[model samples]
Target: MSIEELNQELTRLRQCLQQLKTDNAELRQAVLEYTTQLKQHKSEQQAALLERQRIEEQLQTTQQFLYSVIQTMPVAVFVKDVVDLRIVLCNQAAEKLAGVSADEILGKNDYDLFPREEADFFTTRDREALNSKKLLEIPEEIIRTKSGETRILQIKKAPILDSQGQPKYLLVVRYDITEHKQAEAQLKQQAIELEQTLKELQSTQAQLIQSEKMSSLGQLVAGVAHEINNPVNFISGNLTYANKYIQQLLNLLHLYRINYPNPAQEIQMTIQEMEFDFLVEDLLKLLSSMEIGAERIQQIVVSLRIFSRLDEAELKAVDIHQGIESTLSILEHRLKPRANHVEIQVLKDYDDLPLVECYAGQLNQVFMNILSNAIDALEEALIQGKLSHNHPQIRICTQQLNAQQIVIRIIDNGLGIPEQVKQKLFDPFFTTKDVGKGTGLGLSISYQIITERHGGSLECVSSLEEGAELIITIPVVQPKQ
Candidate 1:
C-alpha cells in the first residue's frame, strides 16, 4: 500500500511541477515582450522631447529676427492699435522724430506727445488706413515734433489685419521733407539775387562805354585836325601873294599895250599865239578856287572841334543845333548814295530849344550813337531790298515836352522790330544784328548817359508793322550837385 501511494504522489507532484514550469515559461515570454514594448516606448519618448526642444528654439529665433527687423529700419516707423488709436510700437527713427525714447513712445498716443490738432490728424489717418484695409499715402503733411520743431513729411500707412480679416493695427512710415523745401526756397532766392546782380553789372558797364566813346572821338578829331592843318596853312599863306602877283602882271601888260598902240609884227604875232586875254582871265579864276577850298577846310575843322567837346565832362550850356549839325557833318558820307545802296534821307524837325545844361561830350556821343543807329537801320533795309520802292529814311524831332523836360525822338523807316525784341532794346548784350556784326552796347550806353547821368527817360516805341521809334526825355533843370 505504501509504494502505490508514493508513486501516485510523485506523479501528482510531477504534474504540478510541469504545470509550474509551463507557467514560468509563459511568464518569461510575457516579460520579454513587456521589456521590448518598454524599450520602444522609451525611444518614442526621447524623440518627442527632442522635437519639442527644436520647436521651442525655432520659435525663439523667429521672435528675435522679427524684433531685430523692426528696430533696424531707417524710416520713422510706428505701429498703432487701431481699436484704441494708441501707439503700440516705434522704431529708432520714430524716437528721434518724436524726441522721446522708443520705450516711452510705445503704448502712448499721438495726443500725449503732439498738439491736439496734430493728434487729430494722426488718429484720422490711422483709422482711415484700418477702415479701408488698404495702404494710405499722404504726399505732404506738416507736423510739430516733441522738440517743438516743425517738419514737412510724406507719410504712408498700411493696414495690418487680424486672422479674422478685422482691423488690427496701423503700420505708419514717415519720410521728412523739410530739407527739400528749404533747399528749394534757397535756390529761388539765389536766382532772384543773380538777376539783380546782372542788372547792376550791365548798368556799370554802360557808363564805362559812354566815357570811352567820348574820349576816343575827341582824340580822333584832334589827330585829324592836326594832320589837315599843315596843308591848309601853307595854301592860305601863299594864296594872297599869288593873287597879288597875278594882278600886278595883268596891270603891267595893260599899261604896255596902252603905251605902244602900234607894235612890231613879231610882237603882235607872239601875243596872238600866246592867247594873252584868255590866259590872264584863267589865272585869276585859279586863285579864287584855292581860296574857296581852304575856307571849306577851315569850316570842317570848326565842326570837328564843336563835335568833340573833349573838356565837357561836367554839365555845361550847349547849343542843340550845333550838336545836331556836327553829327550830320560826321555822317555825311553815310547819307550819300553808294553803289547798290540808296541814300538815307534824314529829316530833322528841331524846335527852338533852350540851352541844354548837360555834359557836352556825352551829349555828342548820344548824337553820334542815334545817328549811327539810324544809318544802320537804313542800310539793313536797303540790303533786304525793302528800301528799293520806299527810300530809306530817318526822322529826328526835338521839342519841349513840358516846362522842365525836353524830348528827342528818333524814328526810323525800316523793318519794324518785334514787340518781344523791342522790350529788350536797351538791355546790355541785346542786339538785332548778326553775331560779330554789332557789339549791342551802343544804345545801352547812350541810354544810361541820358537817363542816369542827366536824369531822363529813354524808351523805345515800336511795332511789328511800323518801324522803331526811340524817345528820350530829359529834365530841362537837372538836379543840383
Candidate 2:
C-alpha cells in the first residue's frame, strides 16, 4: 500500500516538472524576439537623427551663403521692416554710402538717419513699394552723406513677399551715378566747342581760297584787256585814214575818166576788166565793216576791264546795274543755245537804284556766281526733262527796300531744289551737282560776300515742282568802318 502511493506522487511531480520546462523554453523565445525588435527600433531612431542633423547643417550653410552675398554686393542694399519701415539689414556698401558704420545704421528709421524732408521722401517711397508689391525704380535722386558729401543715386525699391502673398520687407538698392553724369556733361560741352572750331576753320579756308581766286582772275582779265586794246586801237585808227585816202583816189580817178573819155582802147579795156565802179563801192563797204569790227573789239575790251575792276580796290560808289551788265557779258557764251541745250533767257527788272558804296570787283564777283549757278540749274532742268514744255528762264529784279536798304532777287524756272537740299545750299562744300562738275563753294562765297562783307541777308525761297528765288538784301550806303 505504501509503494503505490509513493509512485503516484512521483508521477505528478514529473508532470509538473515537464510543464515548467516547456514554460521556460517559451519564455526564452519571447525574450529573444523582444531583444531583436528593440535593436531594429533603435537603428531606425539613429538614422532619423542623422537625417535631421544633415538637414540642419545644409540650412546653416545656405544662410551663411546668402549673408555673404548681401554683404559683398557693390550696390548699396538695405532691408527695412514693412510695418515699421526701420532698416533691419544693410550691406557694407550701404554703410559706406551713408558714411556710417553698420552698428550705427542698423535698426534705424529714415527719420533717425536723414533730414526731415529726405526721411519723408524715403518713407513715402518705401510704403508705396510695399503696397504695390512690385519693384519701383527712381531714375535719379540726390542724397547727402554724414560727411556732407553730395551724391546722385539711381534707386530701386522692391517688396519682399512671404508665402501668404503679404509684404514682409522692403528691399532698397541704390547705385551712385554722379561721375557718369559729370562726364556726360563734359563730353557734350567739348563736342560743342569742337564743332564751333571746325566751322571757324572752314570759314577761314574759304576766305583765303576766294581771295586768291579773285586776285588771279583780276590780273588775267586786266592783262587780256591791255593786250587787246592796243591792237584794236591801231586797227580802228588806221581804218578811218585809209577810208579817206581811198575816197580821194577814187575822186581823182573819176576826173581822169571823164576828161579822157576818148582815150586809147587799151586804157578802156583795163578799166572795164578792173570793174572800177564796183571796186569803188565795195572798197567803201569793206572799210565800214573793218571799222565796225574794230569797235566791237574795243567794247569787249571795255567789258573785260570793267569786270576785273582792278583799279577799284577801295570802297567807292558805283552803279550796280553796270556790274550786272559786265557779268552777263562775261557769261554770254554759256547763255546761248548749244548742242542739245536751249538758250537760257534772262529777264531783268532793275529799278533806278542810287549808287551803292561797295567794293566794285567783289560785287561783280557775286553777280557772276549767281548768274553762273542759274545757268547751270536751267541746263540741269532741261537735261532732266523737267522743262520739257516750258523754256528755262531766269529773272532778276531789284528794288529800294527802304531809305537805307535795297533788295535784289534772282529767280529761276528750273527743277526746283528740295527743301532738304535748299536748307543746306549756302553751307560750305554743299552741292547738288555731280562730282567734278562744281566746286560747291560758289553760293557759299556769294552768301558770305553779301551777308558778312556787305552787311546783308541772303535767303532762298522755293518748293518742289516750283521755281526758286534767292533774295539778297543789303544796305545801300556803307556804314562807317
Candidate 3:
C-alpha cells in the first residue's frame, strides 16, 4: 500500500513541476516582451522630446529675428498700449531719437518722456490714431530730445488690432527730417545769394557799356572842340588886326579931312550918297562891334578847349578851382536867366588848397557833370515850387581835409531824393528823372569816375524835402594806377 501511494504522489509532483516550469518559461517570455515594449516607449518619448525642443528653438529664433529687425530699422519704432497709453515697445532707433536707452523709454508715456506741450500734442495724435483704428500719417512733427536737440519728424501711427479686431496697441514709426530741412534752408539761402550776385554782374556789365559810350562821346566832343579852337583863334586874331587897321585908317582920314577942308569931288559925292556922317559914326561902332564879337568868339573857344581838355591825356597836378571855373564857364548859359526862369545863384567857398594830382581832363568833366546836375536840380525845384523860402542856390565848397586828402562839397537847395532811392543812387540805370531826360547813368558814371578812376569817394547826403549835399573826398596824392 505504501509503494502505490508514494508513486501517485510522485506522479502528481512531476506534473506540478512540469506546470511550474512551463509557467516560469511563460513568465520569462512575458518579461522579455515587457522589456521590448518599455524600450520602444522610451525611444518614442525621447523622439517627442527632441521634436518639442526643436520647435522651442525655432520659436526663439523667430522672436530674435523679429527683435533684430525692429532694432536695426532706420526709422524710430515705438509701441504704446491703446488703453493706458503707455509705451510698451521701443526700438533702438526710437531710443536713439529719445536720447535714452531702451530701458529708459520702454515703459514711459509721452507725458513721462516729453515736455507738456509736446506730450499733449503727441498723445492727442495717438488717441486720434487709436480712434481711427487705421494708419494715420503726420507730414511734419517737431520733437525735442533730452539732449536739447530739435528734430522734425515724419510720423506714421497705426493701430495694432487683436484677433477680435479691437485696437490693442499703437505702433508709431517716425523718420527724422531735421537734416533734410536744414539742407533745404541752406539751398534757399545760396539761391538768394546767387540771384543777388547775378544782379550785381548784370549791373556791372551795363555800367561798363555805359562807360564805353561816355568815352566815345568825350572823344567826339574833344575833336569838335579842337576843330573849332583853331578856326576861332584865327578869326579872333584877324579881327583884332582888322579893327586896329580900320581905326588907323579912320584917324588918317579924319586928319586929312581936317587938313584939306575941301575933299575930292568923287570922294565927297560917294560920302554924300552913302550918308557920310551917319556912316562915319556907325563905321566906328561897327568896328567896335566886330572886335567885341571876335573877343566873345575867342572866349567861347577857350571855354570849349578847357571843357574838353583833350590834350591832357595823362595825370597832372592842377588847380581844382580852375577846373570848376572852366566847368562853370562852359555851362554859363544854363546858369544864366532864361526866358522862363531866373538865374541860379552859385556860391563858391574855396580854400587855399595845394594842386591836386589828378587827370585834369576827367576832373573837368566831373565838375561839369556835377555843376550841370546842380543847375538841373535848382531849375526843377523852382519849377516844382520847392523854392518857397528863398531863391534856388548852389554852394560849392572846397576844403583841404588832411595832409593826405581833400574834400569838395557841392550843396544845392532842391527837392531831395527819397531814402529808399538814395540807397540805390549809385546803381546803374537807376534814376528819378524822366525816361528821355535822364539816361540814369550820370551819377553812376560820376561815381565810377571818382571812386574807380581817382580813388575818391563821392557821397550824397539828402532826404525828402531836404537839400542835397554831394561830398567828394579824394586823396591829395594820387595812387599809381
The lDDT for every candidate, in the order shown, is: 0.84, 0.88, 0.85
Model 3, TM vs. native: 0.66
For 1-481, candidate 3 gives per-residue lDDT tens digits of 6999999999999999999999999999999999999999999999999999999999999999999999899999998997778989988889889999988987789988899999999999999999999999999999899999989999999999999999999999999988998999999999999988996787788777865765676688777777877877887788788878878988998899899888889988998899977987998898788778767766766766666666776787888888788778778888888766788888999999999988777777678767778788788877776677657788999999899999999998888778898899877778878879887777877887799889999998997677888888888888875
- Candidate 1: TM-score? 0.64
Candidate 2 weakest ten by summed lDDT: 381-390
Candidate 2 stretches greater than 4 Å from native: 1-58, 75-196, 250-285, 383-385
Residue 298 deviation, candidate 2, in Å? 2.7
Error of 3 at 470 (Å): 0.6
Which of 1 and 3 is ahead in TM-score?
Answer: 3
Model 2 steric clash total:
0
lDDT of 1 by residue, 79-165 (tens): 888768788888888888888898788888888888898889888888888889999999999998878899999999998888999
Candidate 3 weakest lDDT stretch, 10 residues: 300-309
Model 1 pairs in collision: none
The lDDT of model 3 is 0.85
Least well predicted 10-residue stretch by lDDT in candidate 1: 205-214
Regions of candidate 1 where Cα sits further than 4 Å from its true position: 1-174, 184-216, 226-296
For candidate 2, what is the TM-score? 0.70
